[model samples]
Target: MTTATGPDLRERAETVLATLAGPGARLREDQWVAVQALVEGRRRALVVQRTGWGKSAVYFVATALLREAGAGPTVIVSPLLALMRNQIDAAERAGIRAATVNSANTGDWERTYTAVDAGEVDVLLVSPERLNNPDFRDRVLPRLTASAGMLVVDEAHCVSDWGHDFRPDYRRLRQLIAELPAGIPVLATTATANDRVVVDVTEQLGLGRHDSGDTLVLRGSLDRESLRLSAVRLATPAQRLGWLAEHLDALPGAGIVYTLTIAAAEEVAEFLRERGHPVASYTGKTDPAERLAAEGDLLANRVKALVATSALGMGFDKPDLGFVVHLGAPASPVAYYQQIGRAGRAVERAEVVLLPGREDRDIWAYFASLAFPPEPLVRQTLAVLGDEPLSTAAIETRVDLSRTRLEMLLKVLDSDGAARRVKGGWVTTGQEWVYDRERHQRIAEAREVEQQAMLDYIGTTECRMQFLRRQLDDPAPERCGRCDTCTTPAWSTDVDAGTAAAAQERITRPGIEVAPRKQWPSGMAELGVPVSGRIPAAELAAPGRVIGRLSDIGWGTRLRELVDGTDPDDAPVPKDVLDACVRVLAGWGWEERPVGVVGVGSRTRPHQLDHLARRIADIGRLPLLGTLAPTGPRPEEHANSAQRLAAVWSAFEPPAFGMPAGPVLLVDDVVDTGWTATVAARLLRHAGATAVLPFALAQKG
Candidate 1:
């Protein structure tokens, strides 16, 4: 490694080291190398280090080197508040002056602009959201032109859609980098990235013709020696719950139970609590106080386990977690890795269990369907609003949708820039806003068709490590001795026979074929159930009431509408009534039919009403009863897997020194869950990971 022993670089590194080490200080070999590279004015460098690998030490040293070279100021664009706070705290502890500007702290545009323009701060840490603020662009960024020394894009993987965290705003960072003066070095740091992401980062940041070898790509093994990877097949919901309950006693230190939805999260939390397990729940819906308290309890070891919806692991620094359980399949491998990564941070042996079932896959499919809007819809939406801002109401009128649905579609389009919102409402900027619509749509469709592909790989009767190696395109050893898939005998017979049998039985059952149902209203009887009334009719119709009612009764339903035999203009049933019926039917054990159904009572089972009432009573006792509905999946649950993966790609929370390394486990509901996880995991592992293990609750037989 090139070492910077020059007086100038040495003095700078020493100054920074003195502050970092308190009294007497000495530079570590890696820190010294980083400082030397910075002093050499290398325009681009890739620090590929493992968890607890002192990546930040290198950055801190580089910061000091810039300061010593009389470079005006450095800007650090970080993804998360916790990470920014962590950096700021470190600087303060070292007696080095630093400040962070984020949504939480930017009191006013004027003050923020003044601070940046006046050069009141030395090192500035900011979130991407703050970068788009008009004040920041017009005032703050302009001042940086004269004094901008180095720009660091932290968690750089977020810039790529292929990454776990695909933030639209992050894509605009290229413009920011372009605004900086020529010859100003750019440093991009991330814990994970694949070849694609690295190439994309280099091109996006305008770092042309840089030697890829000199990028300092640090390749780390994906083996987690301290983590035991295991999985269990959950033939039924009761079995899954029982397995969780049984394992609760064996877990030591902090633990996390990842579920597919908020409802599942709450259910698992309550079930554990009822079984005398000290547990808490965390989801996007969790209030700030609840979230903080739950996080604090987990960190302080006051709570043994936290049942969460992929929201508990980001920016969390707990290193001694004993176990992380997937109550259902995580949406993707990326999600699985991030959740599992939360455990064994303190170096002790930790365990991860993936409870697989068909229900998990169904949940994943449902969410994946929403991730990318249909191509026709995107095309039509753009066509209708050619560069004119219209009120949300007007857009709804044009699209023939409820305000809620219109808003969601608009938001998705806005993110892609196929549409933008002005004061009045939303408008399509142009066709350029539609980003690879065909590719995006294909990815979405692949999620449906290839649901079994990942599950087959995960549950393969072949070498598990080999399977992972193939999936990740890893060029190292052909076999990884670890992994349940590697050790478990590959079963020639259908791996998910039970789930397949159940779905097949439902599909082949003799039943009356009804026309496809449009949106509808809830009936009084169906609405009588407390948790059943909260869901809208649209959800009930798409999945159908039979599946919804079955879900209410605790039976898993994986229903998808077969697009045929339906009048597009048919008057939809009342939303409330439809939701209630779905809830009621789900409780009755009505097998979800393959084709869509308009009327109720297509295939009713016995005692469904009783089960629905009991489920409502069961849900009523839970703390999240009012906060999250019992009948349908929470909105947050739909995005749980994606969010977790995004957190890994976007949120960079450095491990504390002396902490043990842990393997990242991506949990999802089903391997067929979505491409989100596959894409996410590929990116994370490519970004210099030690290992990425994926766990699913269930797979399609």
Candidate 2:
């Protein structure tokens, strides 16, 4: 009930709001409250509102008012590159100078820092990842923190470990907030936080203060009248794709088509394009320029949809996005809500649908394995990371971690004070690091609960929008009357027989090439393995074949079932799979057909490999050079390249033919890291085969 107290404050804020939002636009009641809290009271505030509810307007107006009072720049700790781009543009519209310092614009950092020092930048947007940059942390951040007038955490839900989109980089915000000057206004905003996430983030924001009672929290009901939510439980992946191809254009306006995996996104986009839909694929692996173009196409309404993964979520502002369709349900209702928030922002109605698939949980389990590495792995990483800094490439040789997993682990450790990234690369801090198993276990449990809730959402006949609102700890007194459950169903239940058959054929006709390892893994010297440098061309295996990616929907599903079996009865390859291998060979068109077949004897799937090799040799009339016997049990399937290489090196002994050298076909159950194939191929070549062509039933992409 305290008065805002300054007549000029309200007048200037009105004018700034007019410029930021359109000329006739005015702040909502909660928006004005947030601006007043930051500018006049200099109080900490958290705003949890639905998307397009003017959260950005609150900060832009605060920045304008604060700058008018001669304050330093408002530092916004944003999450994604797309979020940063939207923020920079919003800042400009409010007549505030904004500059971003992120990984994308490295060359502009000097100029950006100079502008900040000179007090020419009014609002500075920075990615959370930048907070971990050694140069930014040691040099630039101190000055920015000491002089910053306000700190705005956009997408603040990510600050909480309990959030659906938890990021280690966002955790560094706790230390940053503690370092800020007392009474400097701080604001946190997110559209997709439940009660738990909100509490965690509020506590994080109040770390420096003894009491959080004064921290203003404005929690609004999560109800979007503009969205007409619905779900269609498709039995097969092909049926879902076929439904999308036939019905995508019928959805109101240009929006997004979300898929669970990058492979799915690419496949969906390709199928849509072949069916004559103008769609582009967007994923984390997309090139930077291509991402911009894809975003622009969707924004311009030039394409029907951007087939994308979670990369397209968070702070992508398009006022009139018309629809959102999911090929597969996201792992959590919170995340699904955030993605569907992209639609119907400015329109009276936007269509939203989910086509849940059976294979989604398998994908989720694969992702779950990437959680914070085990304690042993972490300790091993620290032991190799000495006082002297070692580049990631150098560390990769000594560590058995892949590039992505290693970098993610390094960031978490860096934020936790157990590791530091200096000028050269990464170094251990010699600090004690606890595993905190109970906490991660709780998180895992919560994830499982969310996933079950998602399944319930697909099965529930109750109000779809209301169920989502309840998942976010918001109540809806009555059902949303627009969803499929609330109203009569509007779409057809089945895809045409022809279309479904063609879609299934397209997905089932699989022959994915497994590229051979050309260069040896780095840092092998550190692991007591002397081998390094490029793999010799003669010794390396030729590009081989797999029926499909284990992440793919068609043959991949069967492959996963085959490899993940608990019983010994499933060892031998099935006839359909064997016939599929023949189809692969018939279509592969190698420079020369294999003169002989050699099975990489498996300790696990021995019958499958032997049967596949024997059948291929029998059909091709090629010599059966017999098996590559193992000295011991094969390496752990989940082990990284270097570890697998160490286990498989000198482990395989191919039978000597004592005949003229010729190309040999090496068969295995799966191709994951390719190190096993590399080692086995080397042995086969040394045993007198001119070349080795590796083949597997599946590729774990």
Candidate 3:
């Protein structure tokens, strides 16, 4: 193998680019600069260029040159499986052997490691989470880090907590970079980071804070000439769906329709399918196999669009994707730019639209609530920590945090050196950890500022592309004489009344199954709940129904209003909500009909529950069984499953009438954790009820 000198580096790079992209493909000036910096200068560089700028070309060309020069394999810390797969294909096209070690390919790790050990592999792709993996970090990483030719951090914006899509796992890369030998070229690339995020990521990519001055920062104009940006304000979800039904096919080729929540993704996908559009739902909850199949379908143009959430947001590259539509605006323009970047990469033109919704803020609030908890909660978590390792579930029992929040906190603590994750679980290091209240507050405030900026973008009469670029602090901002405001509207805002009516009917038709909990949450005994394993069949509530999830686009809108605490606590159920409840009961395909109705006693919203139960009893011509009385005040909000069950275990007393003769309907206004219903149903069974059929107006998914 002949290593090209600095004089011929550009010539060699263009040759590799031609093979990787196409016969006539050539390197852009900035691309050549990045490649030279890595291959010749062996310097750290941060590239903040828009999509389709051929950032991969720079890295792959550098890898090719470095390998011929007898350097070790390039290690790329990519964020997603989709991105890794794409990079591998690109590497193979350039005749560079690339292998990935991610959760999806555990079975192939041994083979991959062996190939890396040999000189057979030129590049190794790894997910950021791999850096924190116990076995991989301890055994495989040291060898790779010590001998790595170049290090690449793709989607590098994730390293900054101030960034829109920050992940704690990505922060582990700082240590990895710190340990890398000097003169090992490092490249961090992202398309969506702002000025603040760029500085943060550059500092981390450098060897140390003072040495960050040496890192080359190349930022290009954040402009997509192929995208026609537009925002349509729809008064209702029905109108939005109606617009999609009418206009989805008129857009260029196939593309993605992004939603804010998993439920919304499923809901929109189902609606679009019913409207005769071939679409599939892709979300975090989607099975891994199904996700792969869906991705394949989109790539092959088998589906018109994929209704997805942020799970499909980053690193999904579909060149020539015709359009990118958002059912609800992302809270940050930076995040929105990253998602829509998937489109217009290889096409002459593509459509980018945002159908801003009133519920977007509420959805944003829900996600923000899961951010780092209050200081007292953190202290409570630390107080329970000992030298002995405690699993997340066990820690959850001691703290009043949800599983997601608890796991995130533990990861943060581990990164801060206050906690260590070993084979068993997490153990405290007894290192004094101060809560960075100012930093957290700044992050929270920045979120609010970004959210307001997004709203402003939707309502702005200025050029949409210009507004987005300015939000990202693009050095050069220019009005693209495209977009709805910059020029005449390319898309009609009119929603066909009949189509909207049909959409309303589809969305309004609601009944979501509430699967009963079978197994008791682990470590329940630690919370003073003796039960463990599966709950006995005698005490288990039958699979029930909720009118809708709080995150739903249709019935969820009304349900959210009913239980969002804005309404009077003593208010009765609305007439329309009652009608929806009746509709749900009419369609329930239960083998055994309920002979009576019993309401779960509520200190808050008692009138609502009582009125709903009595009305259902009257309509069904069944006896209204007595309501269970609350034995305590409402349990603390956001309690994990075990703590929630413990608090609600003795919180409800059996009805004064003792028990109903047959299967009884257990009613509540809303079910958050489902523990209240679980405990109440068990109490009714203990009181000699034949069965308990639980139901709720809305469920918080």
Candidate 4:
């Protein structure tokens, strides 16, 4: 066992890098500096370099050196399972044994834990969320902190709210670092952090102080020499798809096709498959096993591409990935840079193209709506919470927030020490929590700036690479002669008519399953609703169909226009949309056809809802059973399931007479939470209707 120091340190690092990469591999100058700072100086460092600049090498090499000196295992706080798997494989290549404990591999945890405790593991990678898990935080982390030789924070930008991708879970690392023994070497690495994120992450790494001088920040040029950047503006999404259908195979090599939403990812993958391209859809909703399999297929080049959403934005490692084609631009230039950074890592030249859509800003706005809630909402949440533990669903019943927003708020509150998440649920900590209105406002404004920058990046006639690099505040931004603006587009932007037709046909093809709400939202009884659990079979609405989801690439755009762009005045449904709705009904393989139509009264689109229901009944030659009368104004918009259910529980009154004896089609302009339809169907069931089949123009994604 020997210590790694001075000249010996570089030699050890080279040996480890050669083993990790290949025989000819040697440490880059900055890579050595990072390793030396960690191994010899035992200092904290933030290494912000390009995607393929070997940041992982620094940590792995330092781990090898530190372990050789009989130090404890290096514990890496990684963000994703894919990244952990990649890191473990990379460590094994250098003869440094590594293991991980994440949600995906719970079965291996005890074994991994035993190995780590026995000093048989050289590196241990844990997800950021694990840092807050009670078992890990109370038992495992303290031990790891006491004996860990080096700490690494991968994708450290997530630690800052200012980052494009922030996770409250990453904030727990600040507490972990504060508890670490003094002088422990720490490394935070990210490829996408701008100066703001850099400052925020540096402060977190500096023992939780903004002015701590013990941290080293190594930022390099963001230029990717092997990436040929370009943007292709098409008249429509169909044209973009047509371009992909015609040219995906002609790109440099196998790569990724990015979409903004899950429906788009699945839709794009399916269309590509129809066009005889080997592709798979990957999204946050994809099964863990399927995601792993898709990742493997992409790695082996078994598929031409994996059409994916932002879920694939981080931690996927494929050095020779050939290209990245975005169907729609990401909201932020910084985020765009991070996504495209996945490509051209080891390839001589990988194609990076953006197909900016007219709908990109709409998608951006959808995400922006999920930002921090207003101060009043936060105060309301605090008022409802007490010292007693309550599940998130229980809180949702008391608050007016949707489940996602509630969870986000809770995480923020937990990070701020205003609340604590326990075994069963969350408990208020009685700590003073100030809503940082200014900070949140600044972040929101920053997001807007980033979005504008992305749009500008698409329309800019200047060097594309320079624009992106400058957005990341890269110190040495320069014109990349390879980009489309600097030179001619390396690939053709033409979309064949036949290809465009096929794409348009595929996208316009509509119908999405609107799954029934089997179980009533929990705590509904607390809200004065009679239901508390699963709806009785006799009262449950049959699973039905919508023309399409609001997130659909083709029908979605039109539906959004109809629903969001239209004035409040009542109007008949467009002929094409009505035709599409009819087609959906024709294709629905129901056990029994609806005998009548029953409309759910709508406050926002009364004329449209009534017109749609009347037309649906007339088209199907079913009787008009009459619309359900609203007992009150539309329930509070954007409320959670429990709150929504409670609000609509008795809000609709069924017709007193002329009850349908058979199945009835329940119609609405849109189904957001599905609670409105649920309550209406339940009312119809109780009103002597045999069955209720929900039909809607569109379902919100």
Number of colliding residue pairs in each model: 53, 2, 0, 0
For 483-597, candidate 2 gives per-residue lDDT tens digits of 9999997678689998898889888886878889998876676667678899987788888998888888667788887766454764567788778888888888888878888
Q: For each candidate, what TM-score against the reference?
A: 0.64, 0.95, 0.97, 0.97
Model 1 scores a C-alpha lDDT of 0.53
Candidate 3 worst ten-residue window by lDDT: 204-213
lDDT of 4 by residue, 1-701 (tens): 45757887788788889999999898888998898988888888899998878999999999989988888999999999998889888999999999999998899999998999999999999998887677888789999999999999999998887887888888778877888897689999999988888888987555444346667888898898998999999999899999999998889779999999999999999999999999999999999999999999999999999999999978898999999999999999899999999999888999999998998888899999988889999999988887788988998888889888888788778767898888888888999988888988999999999898998999999998889888899744467899999997776777899999999999999788888999988887788887777789988998878988888888888998788736666678999999999999999888888878999887777888899999999999999889998887666665678887787888877666588688999998888888888888888898888999999888898
**RMSD of each predicted structure:** 16.6, 2.5, 1.7, 1.7
What tens-digit string does per-residue lDDT give for candidate 1 at 1-701? 23345785677577677787565777766656655665575555655333444556666667666665666567888887667766887666555557777877756546655665676656778787765554565557677655777778877767765555655556556767777776666677765555555666666555553355444443344445556566677566655676666667776667888887775676667767866889999987888678878888987889888899866654666668888888777655544655676677676577777777766676776666445455565566667785666766444333433344455566556645567656556666665763577766665664553455457655766654344334333444655545566566211222244434433333222111112222122222222212223333222211111222222104234212211113243223334333433344334333322111100011121122223323333333311111101122222222222222222222222222121123233322233323323333333334333333332222321
Tens digit per residue, CA lDDT, model 3, 108-148: 99999999999789999999888778789889999999989
Off by over 4 Å in 2: 1-7, 205-211, 379-386, 390-403, 565-567, 658-662, 687-690
CA lDDT, every prediction?
0.53, 0.85, 0.88, 0.88
Measured by TM-score, how close is model 1 to the native structure?
A: 0.64
- Runs off by more than 4 Å, candidate 3: 1-3, 205-212, 475-477
Error of 1 at 179 (Å): 1.8
